[model samples]
Each structure stands twice: as structure tokens, then as C-alpha cells.
Target chain A: MNSLFFYISEAVIGMKRSIVMMLISVITITISLFIFGVFLLISLNLNNIANSINSNLEIKVFLKETVTKTERSKFKQAILKLDHVKKVNYTSKNIAWKKFVKEYPHLNLDNLFENSPLPNSFTIGLDNNQYILNVVSNLKTFKSWVEKVSYGGIIAERMQKFSYYIKILGLILVIILTIATLFIVVNTIRLTIINRQNEINIMQLVGATNNFIKGPFIIEGILIGILGSLGAVIFLKIAYTFLIIKCNKILPYIPIVQNKLEINIILVSVILLGIILGILGALLSLSKALKRYSFNKVK
Target chain B: MIKLKNISKYYQSNSLILNNINLTINKGEFVYLVGPSGAGKSTILNLLLKIEEPTSGELFIDGVSLLRLKDSKIPYLRRNIGVIFQDFKLLPKRTVFENIAFALRFYNYSRSRIRRQVYQVLDLVGLTTKLDCYPTELSGGEQQRICIARAIVNNPQILLADEPTGSLDPETSWEIMTLLSKINMRDTTVIVATHNRGIVDDIRKRVISINKGAIARDEEQGSYNS
Candidate 1:
């Protein structure tokens, strides 16, 4: 156990002395993981925003001109009780007329019409945008006194399709970045291993097991990975803050700003990414160091 | 104890590197291997070290058949055999003290024990003053002495030196030979492979000569007659 600790300590010292290589490795890994983190953040928020918009796309159900106030109340209560329906809000003709007049008082509607021409309607919201299909199917059970049922069907479909594309694109980006990160880390560790060829031979001769010889290099690789991941996390936090400020300035009304919870998740994920990547780099380096070379026999 | 029986190592399906060789060296016996280049002098050392398997023979070092030994056991086998090379093979980046201390690390010796053994061996090689110096800063003879210090630090049962004085001058060569002789006197079986006729002739140790991948002569106290 003491020997293992000594070897690990020695390996760390060796990595420290070779600061240039260590820095380079850290920078490469950080950049790759930062890219991945940014994509993750954007993808998650995009999903949330998409779901919000879908739920708000409500159906407007128009009532018949001769329907009684009691009949309208019954219709409203029945729609609200439906499985998918979240809420039923009644918009009376007088309320609609008043809202129209408030927005456009100079349109001369008073002289053109004797009374409010619009029919009393129900604005029906579903629990989720996907529940629109179920709500539409249930509305078919309504009586002929219902004039029309209108919802943003085409718009909802388009937005859903767009969100799907974005998710797929994000997944592809993640895979590409992960692969690139592994490749860069592995190659960097391989160079370090090659540099220690003589040390490896001496260790082999000393009756050190393969694990004993590889443990240090593996630890070194992991350290490099951790440092790199840490760098990435720092970079990502700064980038996220800067991007949030920039987006707020550019499109303040778009609500693109992330909450504290979202930012915290990003931070945690980036740190975990660093640790995983570091372990991967160490594994790659260990396998290379584990390879035996014969000093007694000519290659 | 080391034993070789009908050991023949062939290459390219045409010629043997070591042909039907049979020999044994008891514990604490000093032996010298001398031959021309590519004459299987190094091959014999490699075989005994278990660095290469003999194609058609059985080898037993301390009653352990190296031929049937697992790959993982090779390092344990090597621990008992101290190897010295002409190139010194010292880690150039490390100080002389570190190089010697490293030999003990493989065996996981205690910290105080490593320090004592390293210092003792450095004193033995007369390199105690240059303990902090790296191999590149040391002279050729000094570097080779450090290699010797490293080999003996573990106090292995067998010391195998392959042309240890090949690059040194005649005076330095004699110094290294004398050091080997001294080490052998301490009861570790020593084997030196060399083409340096002057040093081999002067030593007058037991000699095994090889030519064209075969043992040409084996003498109890041979000279470089070939």
C-alpha cells in the first residue's frame, strides 16, 4: 500500500514537472466538454419552452346564438370535467365586445352594430399540448348546438416537429464531442506513456506487477482529465453567464434566461463530465503503459 | 542454481541462435561469457534471464522451469536476477540515488530500509558523493558504476552483465571488471558477456565461448584464446 502511494505520488510529480503537456491536455479536454455542456443546456431549455407553448395553445369552443345561460353553464362544467381538459373559461359576448372596444375604440363598432354580434365562447386549455388529440376526440361527443372548435393544430404540429429536430441535432452533437474528447485524451496519454519507456522497462525489471507499473500512469491520466474537466466547467459557467447577458440584451422579451436550478444542474453535470473524462484518459494511458517491452531481447 | 538442458533457440526456420546447449551454474559461482558479435553470447544471458524462451529445451532457475512459467511470473523471476547493461539503462532524468532506490521499490521495501540499502550500495560503488547528480551529468565510468549500484542494491541472487564495459576505455574497463570481481567475491553468481579480449583475458574467470550460435568452449578458468 505504501509502495502504491509512493508510485502515485511519483507519477503526479512527473506530470507536474511536465506542465506544458499537462496544460495542453487540460485545455483540449475542457474545450470539448464545454461544447457538449452548452448544447445540453440549450437543448433542455428548448424542451421546456416547447412544452409551455404547446399547453397554452387552447381550443375556442363557440356556443349557439339561442343557447340559454343555464345551457352554457352546463357546457362549461362538462368540458372542464373532461380527462384532458385543464380548465374551461367562459368568454361572454359582452366581455369580448368590451375587450375589442378597449383595444380599438375608434373602429366605429357602435354605429355599425346595434348589439354585440360575437357569440359566447369557451376557451378550453388541455393539461398538455399532446393532450389536444384526446380533447378533440372527446369534443365530438358534444351536441350540434356547438358551432365550431378551433385550436392551433398545425402550429402545434410544426413546433413539435421543430423540437424533435433540435433534440436529434443535440444528441448528434453530444456523440461527436464525446468521441472527439476520447480521441484527444487517448493520444495525449499515449505520448506521455511513450516518453516513459525507460522508466517502464526499469519497473518491469524490478518485479513490479503490470498493475503496479500502470497505476501511476492511470492516476496521471485521471488527474489530467479532472483538471481538464474543471477547466471546462469554469469556462462553461463563464460562457453561460455571458451568453445569458447577451441574450437578455438582444431579445429581452423572449424569456431565454435560465433559472438558478438550471444553472446548478449545468455546473454539476460539467463537473461529473470532467471526472468521467479523466477516468477515460487514465484507462487509455494505463493500457498503453501496461504493454510490455523486452529489454533482454531485441525487438 | 541455474540449469539448461538441450536448449536450442532457432529463428527464421533455418538457423539456431543457441544450438543444443547444456550448462549449469551453481549458486554463488562466477562465470564469464565471451564470443564474437552474433555468436550467441547475449542469447545465453537472455535465456537465463527468462527474457526469451528456448525453442527446444527446458530451463530451470532455482528449480523453477522458466519454459512453463506464466508471463506474470517473469517479473518475480527477474527480481532474483540483477541485470547490468553496457548502456547503463539508468533513467537519465532521475538522480543517482533515485536510480538505486528504484530497484528496491519493485520489492516494496520499507522507507528506512530503501534509504539504508541505497546508501550502502552507493558507498560500495564509490558514488555516495554524486548521489544527487543525474546520469547525464556523470562520466561514462561513473554512470556504469551507478548501474552496478542499482543492480546490487536489491542484492539479487544472480548478477548478469551484458558487455558492461563495452563503451569504457581500458582503464575504466578494468575498474568495472574489478568491481564485478569484488561483487562475485560477495557470493552472488556473476555472468559477464563481452567481446573485450583484454579485459576477459586479464580476468581469468570461468569462460563460455560461443561461435555461430553454438558453445565452442567451456573452461573452468579460461583465457581469450579464440
Candidate 2:
């Protein structure tokens, strides 16, 4: 439509008029988003580390000494068929005694053990950490043959709680920053409105609709928001790359978020959040500016 | 036709802008609203534009009551009535062509159509050569011409100019007045609010003089102070 192009061009011109204010808005948004992105990355890698460790914490199902070969084999098959069960390895009493002796080389257990008293055990690996508690509870149901089920109690829950807290704290801080950024954007738009008062008055006199007059301003906010998001993307990429490299060097064995695709996705979300913030700021300031514009100038 | 029946406006309880005023101007009639500063001449123009509603009164144009019109219809109502101001309110950064074409943005006119209309209005105001000049680049008279061109670009049935020649020299004032009169000849009702005694006397038209918030005189072939 004819009006769409006009709105875009006018928005561009308006920004050109108040370029400094626009830059300030962009910088403020970028800083806010960058800090927000840092928290997101931290939470993401924390989850990554927890996942690596949980996969290794397999459930050790110790079997009763009186269980027969057929029953033991059937129990192992049932565990393998469980929804979250990935793999199950059977260790006989002889193998368990040998592994225990190897782990504790200094102890003189030859006389105390008598005839290899260690029970046969089934080591069960699961597909995901979320299934650990449920699988442990399910293993306990085979009470006739199963003596005990242990999957490093309380550690998985503690890791989950810690990550959840980090995410919540990050969300709170980002919200505060977003609010502050919104105020800055509102202030910048106020200056733009004042700068373009003459044009607005002219538009009003020409019988232009309020939407037509306000279109450029809304577009200005969106543009500033988009620009700010791009700035954040660049800053996040550089800062994350540097931090990731340093983390790898300092804690090489620790798992973290190093994949390119995941980083890209987070950046995309930040961009979307920036645009939403921009629109909100624009709408907020516009209502205030327009409600009083004609009243003060045209009255 | 425009009609105001007992129109009154009050900014504050103690300060009444337009006191129980009544007037009528028919279609295609050229009229001058002559008054001293703060005599409520501008207020009358503002009321006609519905920029400010009357505190207590009725305004009718073409037999429709403006007070009864919804807020959403105000823009469409304004489309038929063009207004120019004393300060030649042209966008300073925009070229003369853009300044005139700006008014046509409300409608869905094509680019070429808008260009044609802008050129036509510029020619009508005898400033076709200054199409690309910015407002600052033009003289006082030329700037006012751009303002007029923008006002009439939409082919509005009524044009209200508040002190259109307030900042011009005597010759330039005559030039602007002549253009307005020429546009009036085309059957567009013209209402100019001014206190220029020279132009009012020289150009014979309906003049309405206001003292305070009430009409002091309304006469055909009226002068500045008669």
C-alpha cells in the first residue's frame, strides 16, 4: 500500500534525525540481552554436565544368594525390556569378589571372605536421568530375588534443583534488565516524537489518521529493537566463544555446551525477545506521547 | 454548508474562549475571519476542524451534526476540509514535492497518481519550478505556497487558512491572497483568518470580525475594521 512505504520512509527519516538517541537505545538493549544470554548459557552447560554424570551413575541391583540361574536370567531380561533401560550387565559372585579385591589392594581379605561372599549384581544403565528414580523404585518390586537397588541417591535430585534455581535467578535478572531497557526505549521515542512535532501537526492538519501518523514511530521502535538484537547476537557469540575456550582449557573433562547449532538457537530466541521488548516499549511510549501530543500543540 | 449554533468553548471555568457564538458560511463562499489577537478567531477555525469540540453547542456541515459523529469518523470528516497555518507548517527536511504529496498519503493513491496531483497543485500555486526545494531553501512566500499546495492537494471542498499571510511582505501577501482567491474561483469554499487591514480592504469578500469571543460584525464586501 502507498501508506506502508510512506511509513517506512518516515520512520527512517525520524531515526536519522535522532540518531544519537537511537544508538543509546540499541546499546542499552544489547547489554541487557548479552547479560541475559550469559545466564542462559550457564544454565544450558550446567544441564549438559549433569546429563553426562547421570548417564554414568548406573543402578547396581544386588541379587539374593539363593536365586537360580533361570530366575536371574529372566530378571535381567525384564530389566532390559523396561522403557528407560539401555543396557544391563551381569556380574557373578566370583567376578564381584575379584573386582572388590582389585579396588582395595591393601586390604588382606583372603581369610575374612572365606569363599567369596560377594553377591551377584546386575549393573543397569538408563537412557535418561529422569528415569533413574522411577527405575530404582521399579527394581525394588522384584523383592524375592533383588536384595537392593541403588542409583546414587539424592545427587541427581540435587543437580536438578541447582539448575532450576540458576534458571529462575537468571529469569528474574533478565526481567529487571528488560524493564530498564524498556524505560530507555520509551525515553528515546519521546525525544523522537518531540523532534517530529511539526511533521505530526502537518499530518493531523492533512486529515491523516492517527495510525498513519503513529506508524513511523512504531516502526522506529521495531527497527531499533532489531538492531539491538543483532548487537546482542554478536556480543554473545564473542563472549561465549572466549568463555567456552577458557572453560575447556581449565576444566577439560567437564561437559559443556559447545555445539554450534544450540548456540544459534539461543541467539534466535534472544532476537525474538528483543523484538517483543521493542514493540512493548513503543506501544507504551506511543500511548503516552500521542494522548498528549495534539492536546499540547494543536489546541 | 457549515453552521454553528450557539457554539461556546471554555478552557477553564474562569476563561471562556468562545462565548455563545453563532454563524453560518454557505458552500463555495470565500470568507475572511478578521479579529485582533486572542479574539477567538483561531478558536473558531479550530472548532470547525473539530480539533477542539465546543463545550456546549452544535456544529453541522452538509446537514450532519459533528457532535453526533463518532470519534472514528473524525479523520474522514477532516479529509473534506483542508487547513493551512500561519507558520507555513511544511516539513523542513522534505522537498517541496514531498511536502505537497505528504497530504495524499492517507489515501491509497498510486505513486504516479500522487506525483500528478502534487504537480497540479504546485502549478496552481505558480510554484512548479520549486518542486525539489526544501522549505528552508524557499522564501517566505514560496514556503506559504507549499503549505497552500499541500492543503488543496486533496481537492478538499473547504480550505481554512489561519493567518495564511501573517508572515509575508505586502507584495507576497497579495500574491498568496491572489492564489487563494484563484482557488476559490474553482468552487472550493475558502475561509482565511487574518487581521491584515490592507488585504481585507483590497479584496472584497465576506468578513466576520470578532471582539473577544463574540462576533462584532459579519458583512459582505467588508473591510478590516468596518
Error of 2 at A24 (Å): 1.6
Write model 2 residue lDDT over A83-165, tens digit each, in one string.
89999999998989988887555464655776788789999988886778889988999999998777754765677778899
* C-alpha lDDT (0 to 100) for residue B111 of candidate 1: 86
True-vs-predicted CA distance for residue A280, candidate 1, Å: 3.4
Candidate 2 chain B lDDT trough over 10 residues, lowest sum:
B69-78
Q: Rate the local accuracy (lDDT) of all candidates.
A: 0.80, 0.87
Q: Which candidate has the highest lDDT of all?
A: 2
Top candidate, metric TM-score: 2
Using all chains and alpha carbons, the TM-scores for the candidates as numbered come to 0.81, 0.83
For model 1, the superposed segments whose C-alpha errors exceed 4 Å read A1-22, A50-87, A91-164, A243-266, A285-292, A295-299
Task: Provide the lDDT at A25 for model 1.
Answer: 75
Positional deviation of B157 in candidate 1, in angstroms? 0.5
Task: Give the lowest summed-lDDT range of ten residues in model 2 chain A.
Answer: A290-299
What is the DockQ (computed on Cα atoms) for candidate 2?
Answer: 0.47
